[model samples]
Structure formats: structure tokens, C-alpha cells
Target: MSKPVIIIGAGGHAKVLAESLLRGDQTILGFTDPDASATLFEGIPYLGTDAIIFEHRPEEILLVNGLGSVGDNRTRQAMFSSFTAKAYRFTRVIHPSAIISHIEVEMGSGCQILAGALINPGARLGNNIIINSHAVVEHDCRIGDHVHISPGAIICGNCTIDDMAYIGASSTLKQGVNIGKGAIIAAGAVVINDVPSYTLMAGVPAQQKHQLQGGVK
Candidate 1:
């Protein structure tokens, strides 16, 4: 039997996660959000705030990271790390319609692969990664922890996306490119070269815009 799951956010992404779990025939216990004012999220109850997590033992429920990232993933990364330290277990939520073309594709805990996403052979994804709707992860790609490949983003073969990096919606990364840790790729940007850590890259042929500090998420 699949374990009951609880989501940690109450946003649009959290609703999507709830639907994905239902499609997989998995039961969701509901969600918890400190800033949520609604009583229900897509028919699931709001189970109070962060303090509710303390009420249940880690082994009794599985947690799913429901927070979405536009460019910064520090919040998502921190939450996952914090819950993990408390002995809470997480599981991947792969939409039923997603295509996994290769047996060599490895995904870690708390990863979310949305519908229409294609993960080709030789793609390795680390913990808490998000391969969003219709995103394509080509062969021989290495994606680090807390990385978010936004909707329709295409990562070419042999590309390396480092930890906490965010590839914006519809962005395309050329083959053999290395994206540094915490780098942000803007929407519709086409990257042909390497991006440095904590840099913001944007434009047609992505160029470094400026350096970002810790709080710019």
C-alpha cells in the first residue's frame, strides 16, 4: 500500500501536485501552509501551518515539496533539507502521462516529473528536482539537487545543471553546457556556453546579467 502524503505548500503548484497524486491513485492527507487563508485546496483540507508537521511522526506520512520556483530555489532546498534532518521521508511524484524513455534515468527523493515531460536515457537528477510540464531532459545530462527545469525547457545532451539552479520556462540549453550552482536562466533564453555560479543569465544567447545575493529568490 502506498503511504499517505502531505504537501507543504498551498499554492497553484500544490494543487497540481494533488492532482498528480490522485492520478497515481495515491492518497493525500492534505496540505499545510503558514500563509494560507483558505480552508481547502482543491478539496483537500488545510492542515494548519508548519507546526502541524510536529504533530505527526515522520514515519507515518510522506512529505512532498509543493513549492514552485521561478528562478530561485533556496526556499525549496531549505525545506527539503530541514524535513529530511527531522527523519521525514519524501517520495517522487511522477505524473502518469510523463515519458521515461530510458532505464538509465535516475531521479532522487522529492523529485516531481510533471505530465508531458520526457526524461531520456542517461539523465541523472538529484533530490528535490522538478522536471516541469513538457520539459525535456536529454541523454547524458547531470542535474543537481533542488534544480527546477521549468515548463517546456529543453536541456540538451551532456549538459550539467548544478545545485539549486533554475532554468526558466521555455529556455534551451545547448549540449555540453555547464550551468553553475544557483544560476538563474531567464525565460526563453538560449544558453550556448557555461554560466557561472549565482549569476543571472538572460537574452537570446544567454548572457550574464549580474550577480545575485542569497535573498533574491
Candidate 2:
């Protein structure tokens, strides 16, 4: 039997997630969002608020966290933790168009690897991560939980990105660079150094713009 999936957000990212799931031939039960205006998501029904998950048995349907993190990933992480506490299991959504090389790749639950993304061999991705469209993860990279490697971002070989880090669109991280937890790498920035925790790095060579005290809000 095909496992039914309930998507947790009804936004643009949810549309992408829906398309990925559909391409994988997975059955989608519907979406859950607080926005009553969202009656339909990419032609999929909106199954009311997120509280609706309590109505279904967790074991019977898997969850897909459609909430995307532009900077702060706490919302996505919170949703995953909440659902997990309720004994709900999450599904990893990988687009058919994505290229996965013959490498030892380990992915945690609730990850979304989008179309045109390339995950090289010997890479490890943590829970609730977003490898957005056309993003490239080179060999031996480690990406942490709730990290959003935005569209077209290139993570070079042997890089380490810690939890809740957001690498903006088209940004490139040099090989062997370490990005600390909760750091934000700006769009188009080229990172060549280790970023400190909760730091905002921008510009070419990626200087620290500011420290995100207490992390992203």
C-alpha cells in the first residue's frame, strides 16, 4: 500500500513539496495550515489547521514538513519535534529529477531534495533539511538538521554546515569550510572561511556582517 502523506504547510514551498511527492508516486492525503484562505494547494485540498493531525493515527499516515526556512529554522524544527513527540514519522521527499551519485549518502527524516539538485557520494544530510532546486552538495559534505541550502547554492567538497544554517541562493561555500550553527550566509556570497555560530556572513569571501544574538527570530 502507498503511504499517505500530510503536508504541514500551505505555501509556495508546499507546492514544491507536493510536486516532489507526486513525482515520486506517493499518495498525498492533503495539507494542513492555519490559513483558512488556503483552500487548495497546487490543487491539493487543505485539510484545515495543523491541529487536524490529532484526528488521524500517526502510524497510518506519514508527515511532510512543507514549511521552508528562509533564515530561522526553528519553526520547521519545532514542527518536526512536535509531530515526532506525537509518534508521527516523517517522509523524505526526493525529486526524481535530482541526481544522486553512487556514494554513501545518509539522510535523516523529513528532508526534501528538490529537482536538479545533486548530492554527491559520501555526503550526510541531517533531519528536516532542505536541499533546494539546483543546489549541489559535493563529495564528503555534512549538512546539519533544519539547514536550508537554497536554490543553486554550491557546497564544495568536505564542507560542514551545522544545524539551522541557511545558505542563501547561488551562494558558494569553499571546500573544507565550516559553517557554525544558526549562521546565515547571504545570497551570492562566496564563503571561504569558518563562520561562527549565529553569525551573518555576506560579501565575497563572506565577512561576518553581524552576530545573530540568540539566533534567528
> How does each model score on TM-score?
0.96, 0.97
* Per-residue accuracy of model 1 over 36-147 as CA lDDT, tens digit each: 6854345687888877987899988999998887777989999999999999988899999999876788889998999999999999999999999999999989999999
lDDT of 1 at 91: 85
All-Cα superposition RMSD per candidate = 1.4, 1.2
Write model 2 residue lDDT over 17-102, tens digit each, in one string.
Answer: 89888888889999999887885445678888999989999878999999987888889889999999989999999999999887
Worst 10 residues of 1 by lDDT: 35-44
Error of 1 at 120 (Å): 0.3
Structure candidate 2, residue pairs in collision: none
Name the top TM-score candidate: 2
The lDDT of model 2 is 0.91
Q: At residue 142, what lDDT does model 2 achieve? A: 95
Candidate 1 local lDDT, residue 196: 86
Relative to the true structure, candidate 2 has a C-alpha RMSD (angstroms) of 1.2
